[model samples]
Structure formats: C-alpha cells, structure tokens
Target: YYAEMTLVPVLNYLDIVGTVKRHLLGPRARNQVDMDFYFKGSAFYLADLYTGMSKVVFLCFWYASIIPAVYFLTAATLMVHYISYKFAILRSYRAGPKLGAELAIFGRVYIFPLAVFFLFMQADYNWSSFPFDNVCETNSTKVTDSYIGSHNLQYEYRDKDGGETNFLDNIKYPVEISEGDSYFKFCNQDMYNHSPKVFPAFPFFQDDESKWMSDDQAVFSWVFSILVIVVLTLVVNSILVRRLGASILSYFKASYKPQAITINQRFSEQSEISAYVPMKCDPSFLFPLLLCDISDIDTELIGWEDARNKYDSHNLSTDVIDEMKEDNEDAKCYCILKHFPPKKND
Candidate 1:
C-alpha cells in the first residue's frame, strides 16, 4: 500500500495518461491537437498530492504498532512526496497555485491526533492479548510484591496428559468476587467447550459478566484513547481558531487581493475628512446573522439571552418586503480594516 502510493504518482510525472491518449487516438489525432500541447507543461494539481500524503501518513501511523517497519515506509512516502512534487513542479507541471499553510495546518489540526490515537490503541491491544504465557502468576513473587493494579495472574494451559493447552493470555486482576460474581458458581467443567457467555455474568455482555473475567484490557484501551485524543485535538484547534481571530476571512486570498488593490486604488486620491461624517459600530449585534437560533437549553446555561432577540413574527408580506429591501441595498459598511499580504504569492 505504501509503495504504490509513493510510486504511482511518478507515472503522472511521466504523463502516462498523455501517452495512452495519444496512442489510442491514433497519429492523425496528434497532428490535429492544439499547438501548445507539446510546449505547455502538464497541468499538475498540488491539492490532490497533498491529500494523498495525509492519507498514507495516517495509514502508516495506524498500522505501525502491528508492523514497526511502517515507520520507515512513512519516511519514504514523505520524501517521495517532496521530491516528486518539487521536481515535477519545476520540470513538467504548469505553475502551481499560490498558497499558505492551510493544508499544512489541516494535517496538523486533524490527522495527527487521530493517527496518534490509533497508534496508542493498537499498542495497548497487542500487550493485552499477547499470546505467550506471560504476566505475574498468583504463586509467583511478583504478586506479593506490589499493588493489586500492578499485579496480575494468568491461567495455566498445561493439561494432565502433558499436552499443550495454549490458552489465551488474559490477566486476572484481583478484584472482589461475591457469590453472584464468583467463578466456581458460574464456571462449569465444560466452560471452555461452549461459548464463554453460557457461564455466569451472562447479561449478554461482551465479557463474561464483565471484562475482568474475560479480557479487562480490551474495552478501556480504545475508549480512553479516544477521550485523550479528543482533549488534545480540542486544545490544538482552539489555539488555531483563537489565533486566526476576526481576520479569518482575509485568508481567502483569491478574493481578498483584488478587493484590497481596488480599495487602495480608489482611496489613494482621497486624503482626509476624519474618515467621513459617520463612524458607527454598524449595529453588528442586531444583524440577522448575529440573531442566531439559540435553544432555551443554551440560553439557560450560557446566559446569552440578553443579547439574542427573536426575529419579527410579522406577516409574510412584511418578510417579503424586508428580503426585497435587503437585496436592493447597495451599501457596504467598512470597519477601517487592514489587509495582510498573501503568503508566497508567486
């Protein structure tokens, strides 16, 4: 999977699509093609390449616990992405789009947390289900040495005939087992012959009674991993949005640059007037957009009601007139804002 992702893109660098197209359409079609076809570089898209990189990176991290060598594959994938992208951009593709750290920011803010979580969960699962006869035994010195949480015992698989039992290595954590949850009352001579559920703690739960009796480690590993990932993801993204501030819209460089140039061009000739007679707050809070649909639940808890007002419930005709007037209005209110230069505009 990793090799294909890194190598297949090189085919684009060689323009296999073009070769197949030219050959399939016959030699006559090649002569009739556009004059710029041979001279112009193939139209390469950076966004697709970046997306593939993120996917393969996430894949590697997800499976690295099972196969440690996947880490090396991830490095190779990144190297190929960088080398092929830079080389193709220079030698074959047309000028790529001017951009900022948006894609880089996306991978950081979204993919890394998810990938890390999968890595942790897989590692935990491997330890929990380790097939070898491992862990502290009840009769061993390790059990008497530490806290109950630190000590665990696994069932022996050897039988009387000297045959191998090969039992699953499940840790037996010391916990209170009352008559209702006791192993002898629930377990039978043939407990292993049939399904584990026929034994006690049969509330049809995944574990016999609960995970402690069967596999205590499986359930907690993935759930806590998710919660940890959630907290970290929230903290990182919160920092991102907070730093962006109200100028988030300014990152729309394709739209922003032209407007900035036109505004500067128009205002260059006008010198002063204290920026016109009226400089008001624009009643920003009363705008329809600010009148968000807040639920009573939110109002009771968050106490945003002092600011929120219900839109007028006037007749349909009134709303129609309001909508028409809104559409007809040809004025824009400026907030004396400044525009920043787009990153790496070339």
Candidate 2:
C-alpha cells in the first residue's frame, strides 16, 4: 500500500520533469533571436489563433481560466520540435545519401528511443516481480571436453555397449555410436548444470571468450563499415562533380563568342523571280468573261483516266487547262478579225 502511494507521486513528478526537459532542452530550444524569429513564423500564428479562440470561449463562460495558455504553449513547443526534427533528418540524408546512413539516423532519432522505452518498460515489469527465471537459464553450461586429443577427437564415437569405438576401425560414426561409447557423459542430470570438465563463470558475451564470433563477426562488421563509408564518399564526390560541371557551363556561357550572320545571293535571286503580276481587270466584274473561254471546250471530250494522270502531273484539273487553251484560240481569232476585215461578197 505504501509502495503504490509512493510510486504514484513519483511517476507524476517524472512525467512533469520529462515534459519540462523536452520543452527546455529539445532541438527547438534556441537563443532569444531564434525564439523571436519562430514567433513571427507560421507556428506562432497558429498558436495565437488557438489561444484567441480559447479566450473567446472563456468570455462566453465555456472555459474556466488560463488553462488555454498552458495548452497553447505546450502545443507550440511540440510543433517547433517536430519541425526541427524533420529538418535535422532531411539534413542527414543530404549529408551522405546512403541507405545505411539514412536508416541509422532514422533509427537513432526515432526507433532507438522507442526501443529503449520498451526495454525500460520490460525491465520495470521484471523488477516489480523479483526472483523470476525467464527464457535464459542461469546455470546451463555446454561442455566440449573429449578423452581423445582435439585433432584425433573426430575419430572417436559413442558405442551401443557403452564403450569407446574409433572410426578407423572400419566403422561409420553412426555405426560406431551403436558399437561404442565415446560421446561425453554429463555428471549432472540437469541440462542446465555445467560439466565438471570446463571452467565455471566464463563470460561468453566478450569477444575474447566467444569462439564463434571473435574472427568472423569482426571481419563482417569491418567490411560493412568500409562499404558504407565508400558509398557515402562516392555520393558526396558525385554532388561536387555536378556542381563543378554547372559552374563550368555557366562560365562558358558568360564568355561565349557570338557568330556573324552572312546573306546568300542564291536566295535573293529566287525571290526576284517569284515577284507578283498585276491582273488586267477586277476579278469580280470579269467573272462571265472568264467563263466565255471554257464555253467552247466540251466537258465530255476528256476521259477520267487521262484527266486524272494529266491533273496529277501538272497539279491542275484537265478542264481548267482546256479552258485556258480555248481562251488563247479565241484571242487569236479576235486579233485576225481586227487586223483584216472580212471581204464583203454581196
């Protein structure tokens, strides 16, 4: 009963302390200049809007007191912290651009804290219930002692008759196990108990004591670290190269020479030949006279095939060409009649 009472106030105090620490020492906590700058920013604007709404509610008798101020301050602090954390994470990505480094930074900031919190919770639960054995046993020890020398140990096997038998005696390891007894015999029936053959209390977690990970795990870790470093170095170098390229291009553009323009006489000659010709009469008034030329040409005289081929080659309809031909004939006839009047034979 006393423990529960004590724990409640302690927990409440810890919660308050944590909140204070987050506000005062978090990434958002900065100098006066920075604080003023942030206050003028969007974050401050939102906080003010919320605070104003709260004041309006209090005036209307919906809210009690200055609790709104406290809430607004807390919300503003959390918002600033969130923004700063996001900027810091993005900055880390820009620094290296390596997947591993990005993951590591993300883990450090977000995942690691959560993991620590979970571990602390588990430890707290464990501490509340003392003298309990979990998954790992405290007394178990693996014995590797053999009667034969370490090199010759491979030849020895267990026998069915509870005697030692050797592989070189024309017997398989399994057959020897059935024929002999060479496997280690435990002194205690409890599997958790260590054999009398091995030294007690040897630290298996240490590098010096661990037989499996001392060499292989170290090599793997070293290789992984070197690879991550190389990748990060390459990413930084690539960015630098791109920036240098852009600078060089800008320099070239600034100092570039302009090419002189030269005119060609051939184009000028073609333009002169294509000059426009003026019409003799207004097109609207001479419509009927234009029709008089085609009045002499028979439309049925031209076959479809001939007309199509002729039109395709000349880029004109045969009927139009026949009309022009008739016009020329009529003009010749008129000239003959004007020059030589018809002799009257009355």
Best by TM-score: 1
Number of the top-ranking candidate, with lDDT as the measure: 1
Residue ranges of candidate 2 with Cα displaced over 4 Å: 1-212, 243-346
Per-residue accuracy of model 1 over 132-205 as CA lDDT, tens digit each: 23222222233222233333456777788999876557767555423322122222222223354332212233
Clash-forming residue pairs, model 2: 158-177, 158-180, 158-182, 159-179, 159-180, 159-181, 160-178, 163-181
Report the lDDT tens digits of candidate 2 across residue range 78-108: 4444454345334321122124455445444
My TM-score estimates for the predictions, one after another, are 0.41, 0.15
Looking at candidate 1, the ten consecutive residues that score lowest on lDDT are 273-282
**Where does candidate 1 stray beyond 4 Å?**
18-33, 125-346
> In candidate 1, which residue pairs get closer than 3 Å at backbone N, Cα or C atoms, i.e. clash?
201-209
Alpha-carbon deviation at 238 in model 2, angstroms = 1.3
C-alpha lDDT of candidate 2 relative to the true structure: 0.34
TM-score, candidate 1, is 0.41
lDDT of each: 0.47, 0.34
